[model samples]
Target: MSIDIALYDGHPAGGRRTGARMLRLSSPGAALDDALARHTDPARHRLGRIDPYGDTLFDERDAGAVFEEATALLARCTTEEQRAAVRELRDLLADCAATPGSRLVFLGD
Candidate 1:
């Protein structure tokens, strides 16, 4: 399945964090997404201990940067489909960035 990027008011799965999801670079494979997310900031958007195996992709702080990186990569990939994804990601990032307690989470890798 493709990556599902969304904004949550609090921690997903009924956890204890408060934030929203935003900014998704590309619906690439899990390996690619992890590599990109940790590319610039190694310890930027990391999950919690609950996910010891790192099964899911969750980035709380510095999420905007991660999303920004993804968006930047496709900034010039203006094909119809690419353009839609880019625009959607950009809008989501902007919305979350403007929101106070919004956290951008990239699911499915």
Candidate 2:
């Protein structure tokens, strides 16, 4: 099994809250993680509203640079499996970007 990080549509942290599931990434998604963090820096300059983290929910616009940076990171990968994961991440980001009001709701365990 692999450690997976699942993205949801909104804040779905508590046991009582619910959100739509979006994307799932394999373990050691360092590049993706870093890209997400850089994009969601929460600083005024970054245009984010929260701290730099892949929490339980987020707006697609909030993590705006994630896709580009992740794709750039993918270009440096050396393995087929890693490339595959990046491809999946790229597709997921594309889908999320195209859909307005799309929110990220969870970072699966």
Candidate 3:
């Protein structure tokens, strides 16, 4: 399984959405899931709740919190792949946080 991350111009509504400005990032689902599962406190780590079987949306308002959580997770990454993936997530979250109407979505499968 793999997870795909993308950044969009605004909140995507149903089937009418424009192309995302940022290139989508894909990472091994198991690797990310394992890293998140190892988080010591999932209750406080918002990113840990990413649904591997569904979609996870983070809008501009959620960017700060998501970025913080991603930073924390990045610190605990045991493998290079995990670190790289979380780093990409952090970058996307940062962009979303800075853009007024942008959103980040994690497509899981």
TM-score of each: 0.50, 0.52, 0.80
Q: How accurate is candidate 1 locally (lDDT)?
A: 0.47
Over 1-109, each residue of candidate 1 has an lDDT whose tens digit, in order, gives 3455566554555554543333333443343333333333434333211131333433344455545665663554535565565566556666656655556556652
Backbone steric clashes in candidate 1, count? 11
TM-score-superior candidate, 1 or 2: 2
How do the candidates rank by TM-score, highest first?
3, 2, 1
Model 3, 50-77: lDDT tens digits are 7767999888889877777788788888
Which runs of model 2 end up more than 4 angstroms from their true locations?
A: 1-56, 105-108
Clash count of each predicted structure: 11, 6, 0
Stretches off by above 4 angstroms in model 3 are 14-30
The number of residue pairs in model 3 that clash at the backbone is 0
lDDT of 2 by residue, 3-109 (tens): 24445554334333454544454343554444434444455323233232434444577445566755674676566656666666656656666656665433433
By TM-score, who's the top model here?
3
Best by lDDT: 3
